[model samples]
Target: MSDTTTVGPDTAGIGRTRTPTPFRRLLAVETRKLFDTRSGKIMTAVMVVLTVGAIAGRGLYAGPRLEVLIGTAGLSLGTLLPVLGILTVTGEWSHRTALTTFTLEPRRGRVLAAKCLPPLIAAVAASAFAILVAVPVTAAVSAVRHVPADWDLTPVALLGWTAANVLVVAMGLALGMLLLNAPAAIVICLSAPALWSAVARIGSVGETLAGWLDLNTTAGPLMEGHMTGGDVARLAASVSFWIVVPLATGTARVIRKEIG
Candidate 1:
């Protein structure tokens, strides 16, 4: 027998490093996490229920005008998507999973990117789904009530509606990232519009500032597809202040903060 034993193939590769996860995989994981948690699942369910109820209510009582149906569904989705975004970012901290997440990924910016992408996609999907559901319901209501089924939604209006919902979702993500605490993030996200509305009522100067800085006001024209050049300018300014600034600040903070 030989005095020395030969090294095995498995042992020879022991020092080899594993590959980092691809961005696509990261996005998929983040998307799945949105629905995997108990709270995520519950919130999603509530959103769906509210959307269906709103559409159905419109069909039954109010005229199932396509615009009204879209607006109602959009409102429900807008209300809930932010909560979903907040929980998505904060849940890692709340559940003490940040340590593991950072350990595995080691790049906080990529993690944040992963977290942000899902909500935007979800918002677009939810908006489309609402439109799809409304079509059949509107037809049924029109037939029963002998009203014309107005399928007169223009491309611009549809695009604007989707864009408005996406902006709201982005706002929620920005707020969530900025606060990093679920309750505080959620409260601020919900109350900021109302607070700004109060501020806007103070004076002409306040109104002018709000017109440019308040997303609730600036984004309203988008839903109606009636944005003028001024409306577009105001929307841009408001999004820059609310979404861009906070996201930049939050990304820096998250990158620097030590994971416990």
Candidate 2:
């Protein structure tokens, strides 16, 4: 040590920095987590079974018109998909994994984005699955009923159905993130529409507001693939209230709230 005191060789850089986990890796983990739990697996199985059963039932009675088949499956999926999204978020807290998750990925927003994307993907897949199932069912029903199979679903109708499912799942994710409690999130998500429907039926003023802000009314046309410009405007308003506000507020809370 002639000129300078000996220092540890570049130790400053060794422990001071860590490469952040890749976003794609985080997304893959989140996607797997969606089906890794017992409840999650059960819920997924139930959704698939119900979708198949609903389509089959319609084939038996209503003669599996493509619209009827898709509509029936969409109804079942719309209800269940949201529940799936809700569980994806609430389970992190319920299972006491949020602390670890935040520790591994300090940026909570990325985590939330990761959580949101998979459900939307699932929603799209569910719609596609329904369509696949409908094809054979439509064929069988047309044969049995001695009627022409109506595979006349336009691209617009298909797009609308897919969008509707995604919106419902988004609403669920927003509510789950906002509440961070599975029971509360599920309850509110289920009841709010009914409550709004009741309020909408009360008076003309209420009806007018609901016409714009009620997702049930606005999103209904999407399933039928008959959205007008007015319907699009109303859907945007309803989604802003139900999905955007809650998701934004919930994300902010998650970012700042103390993790236990």
Give the best candidate by lDDT: 2
> What TM-score, over all chains together, does every model reach?
0.92, 0.93
Q: What is the lDDT of residue 134 in candidate 1?
A: 89
| Candidate no. 2 TM-score | 0.93
Q: Which segments of model 2 are wrong by more than 4 Å?
A: 1-15
In candidate 2, what are the lDDT values of residues 34-140, reduced to their tens digit?
Answer: 98888879988999999999999988888758988899998788788999999998888999999999999999999989998999999999999999999999998
Q: What is the C-alpha lDDT of each candidate?
A: 0.88, 0.90
- 214 in model 2: Cα distance from truth in Å? 1.6
Q: Cα miss at 140, model 1 (Å)?
A: 1.2
Residue 148, model 1: Cα distance from true site in angstroms = 1.7
Candidate 1 C-alpha lDDT tens digits along 155-199: 789899999889988988888888899899888888888888898
Model 2 RMSD vs true structure: 2.4
